[model samples]
Target: MILDLNQFVSKERPYWDELTAVLKKQEEQPDWKMSLPEARRFHYLYQRASSDLVKLKTFAGEVEVAQFLENLVARSYSRLHEKRGSTIPFRPVHWFLRVFPSTFRRHWIAFMISLFSFLIGGLFGAGVMKFAPQHKTSFIGSFSHLSGKPSDRVAKEEKKQFDGFERRNTFSAQLMANNIRVTILAMVVGVFFGIFTVFLLFYNGIILGVVVFDYIADGQGVFLTGWLLPHGSVEIPAIILGGQAGLIIAHAMFGWGTNLRLAQRFRRIRSDLLTIVGGAALMLVWAGLVESFLSQYHGPTVYPIKIAFGVLQLIALICFLLFAGRTRQPDSIHAG
Candidate 1:
């Protein structure tokens, strides 16, 4: 049952006010330290405010009350989670384990859109190659190296790139640079209303689909899979996450039919964008390393090993996003 706004606010206002005061004090005087009793009081007040916010969300026609609680709770949450010079420090690990996964969980819908966008583009490119072979060159121009079936020369070139430590290091650096450049471009371009971000993702997906389609159509599907999956398993997801981040930034600006003020929307996006971009960049680095070191070692004996490792990497990525930070402090603000 929904309580009357008057009654609910009358009951919860004290706690909310107390939390707001504590957060305000922290913001106004960053160097000020909270005593043991004050810290306990702040925690109690924050928990009460969080509980009231949940109740407010469940009831309709309480927009003003809900908005107040939302802002208050978010501010209080940020204050409590802020780094302190205590023995139990909590900034570095907090971002990866708490903020990143929470952001991922919150924006899953955007991620799905990103995934589908890429898949649709890839399928369209594949169709162009398969149905209208004349336009294949247009779609697969620079990536022609990956097309028209496999050859010994191509295999030897791949091996040569990874044959030595110096070459492998150089290749890894190049891979990271290229992937990070694409990821950053995808994310930053969203500021232009996200149109270019969409085009960039589609272009990347088209290239991938065209190459894969060519290999499969030429009866080199298995070899191509072995060569691609090791690094691509992580690389593709990283790119999709970058797109998700960009879409989020764009959505904040375009309103998406929300009633939030510009400041509110910007705050939400700012909180999430850092964690999303940071996580994606980390994944790209890992993908680059794997691509340079492990992806080029293809053979009857090595192929299954690489594929198995790739599967494990994908599983680990999924598990981290779904499960990490689940056991965080109860009062931590829910990301979104």
Candidate 2:
């Protein structure tokens, strides 16, 4: 299995035969498999090799598949030194990571995993939050309550601010940051038996799932979701992502894969999680602002304004994400 192979044979001959063989077999795998480790391996290899493959597949001057044979030869030689711990003059992984998001999209499992966690956790969290006593005390550890403020203070203030929202809406950099924050909170809450993340999700979920309930509870659901929708849509995803990041850490700590390498995996993953957390923080402020000022201030007459702004933010988000793949590598290296 090329998955079992590390790199190429040597600089003179990368592992083309093995890689090609594996790619051929990999092409037959279910679409979801494209996200798995084996599929990832192929993606990595093929992406590097694609330029040559394209030549053979298309723009050849009536050249045969043998024209693509160079990659095989180059890869074979590259694998030689790679396996032996010698320099194969191979391209660095960072080079390809620049395209990782688009490249990794073929691996739909990651998204499915993320969304599945969001749905299950969000609903579960919502149910527990909606029905559970809001004033109950924990049996262990320390409680971090609001200082000199009622539990409802933050929410009420948030509502007040929403009723008076305004901002120089840029590229929804605020929303991106919001995505990062919600995702982080979701993850950080995992530190408490993951119940916290669940509750957090549940809190938001019920708040989201039953807007009518919120309106009924205080005649504020419409305003809440609306103000929230301006940024909640962005902020919530970030928090969910944060929660997912937390779960990843928890799993690594618990030796999800194996005991021998659990710590090693944690070490490997810590930075990635932190980046996710930081990104989450950035998203929250933006989303929070939308909730605080713009969304709330826009009355029924402001519905059109909200729609127009929301669409703009949505478009801006897609554009930023499109560029994120390119940015990820540079950011990661700087992070490292």
Candidate 3:
């Protein structure tokens, strides 16, 4: 049956106002969770209100129409209402541009702000490198030496990350899946794990910082760059971006409200979060290709190795500019 508007509007105005506020929030900004009852409530409320507003506009006294419109508008905002659905039928260009400045801004901005943590993570990673191996060595000495040795047959079979080969030595599927896995880890862990993402990033940074120190200390810093830069340039940044997304959810939790309403807020943020997560996935794809092909090709030298790294990194950068930059060619844009 068609729902009766009078049954809805005849209710006391103040109570309606409160419910309206919650509903508006759902419309404006959905929550970031699996469930979104608050948003659903707003959807139903707005649909009803829109109907009532039209009815009052048509037949009700002028005073009543104004009141009805006022109530409809009020419900939209009291819950921090934002646009949940497309106002018009379609806005492809608008959506394409949407994730750039709005939803994903926090990912980049958070990184800039968290630069201090990066330095700290590096320091700790270095510390772990210096201290942890020493403690484990006595018991692990034989295994450690064995551990360092490449089990070529097993290594190739598993594409064990420890064998220190990337794309050049490994197969494409291994490269792609592993690279994507790390990128996905960054986003998924952050979203599900919340502030724990800080630890994840920090831990990785620390491990990396220490590794760099070890390589430079051994006068193999150049070699290290050759090994890492090709895939890592893409992989590391993607992971950090994922962590930033997690932070957004954590921040949302800081606000006060009912569980239903919070779910609504998350629902609103999902589209934007996907942009960051998707970017992470893309980076992983690039990393896999670089690791599987170039990284496996040359061993330990800048010319054959690092040279390849520099060239590929540059190509990736150029690709990014052409695709995302304003001056991209029409044909390329279409191709992209």
Candidate 4:
């Protein structure tokens, strides 16, 4: 086949130069990490340059260009296959503050799907409660305590006080254990193509919707908000994050866009799953502490404070997820 060597060299030189610039930058900052898009582009450039070198070798005249392309491909290959180790030590604070949030943003679509499933369940539960009150018991399930009137329950809780710090601590431990178990289950069930994970999320949302609607319908909206928001603000999101991890796992199982093997797909997403679940666990721990220490408290005097705290916490979390880990400077390259 006749080859337009001059046209090809002209067209490919820009890509080769771009690869050179990226390589130079990496050499200057050995700890720098490429974002996903940058990594993909770099890979494409490597492959293209390698192809160009092969084509050039077929012709005997372009020796200098061929050598340059060979070196470019070699450097890119080395960088791509380098040992998966970081020169910088792992820092827990950095991981939580930056890595966790960044990971969450990376899979925001899955998170939205998780949230949507929960909302659908909530709507269903609320509809049942509003239209058919007798079946409340069926929907309430384990939360039989809420079967009674919201006002009566609120009154009882308002007058109730903890007997001692020991009781509070015990309650907190129980809450933590229960919530963490639920969150873990939500993530682990992703192995089943996320069907169970979606159901779990939806079921939890049904309980929430039923409880919230019942309280509001009975004129206990303020009480309900104060009781739930303090801990639910973080606890709810944590559970949703667990759902997100599950869906991510499910996507890997399906392997919709890639031809990678099942093992390879799982390997690619394993770190992301762990990162999301770990973040959720941490959030649940905080939620448990808040629920036991603050959320369980009742009365008009403290309700506003608890509500405010919860709102602020939720806002801070939103900001962290949206903006954390974003910087002009490069980060350390780490596996997903």
lDDT of each: 0.82, 0.52, 0.57, 0.90
Evaluated at residue 209, the lDDT of candidate 3 is 72
Clashes of each: 0, 47, 33, 0
lDDT of 4 by residue, 156-264 (tens): 9889766455588888989999999999999999889999999999999988988999999999989999999999999999999999999999898888999999999
Task: Give the per-residue lDDT of model 1 (tens digit) for 164-192.
Answer: 65588889989998898898888888888
- The global Cα lDDT (0 to 1) of model 1 is 0.82
How well does candidate 2 score on lDDT at residue 235?
Answer: 69
Quote the lDDT for 295 in model 2.
Answer: 56
Candidate 3 lDDT, 217-288, residue by residue in tens: 556555566667777777666666666666666555553354546678778667667776676666667777
Please rank every candidate by TM-score, starting with the best.
Answer: 4, 1, 3, 2
- The residue ranges of model 4 lying beyond 4 angstroms of the native Cα positions read 1-88, 162-166, 329-336
Q: Specify the highest-TM-score model's number.
A: 4
| Candidate 4 clashes between residue pairs 3 or more apart in a chain or in different chains | none
Candidate 2: lDDT of 192? 61
User: RMSD per prediction, one decimal?
Assistant: 12.9, 18.6, 12.6, 13.3
Per-prediction TM-score, please? 0.68, 0.44, 0.53, 0.72
Candidate 1 residue 264 C-alpha distance from true site, Å: 3.7
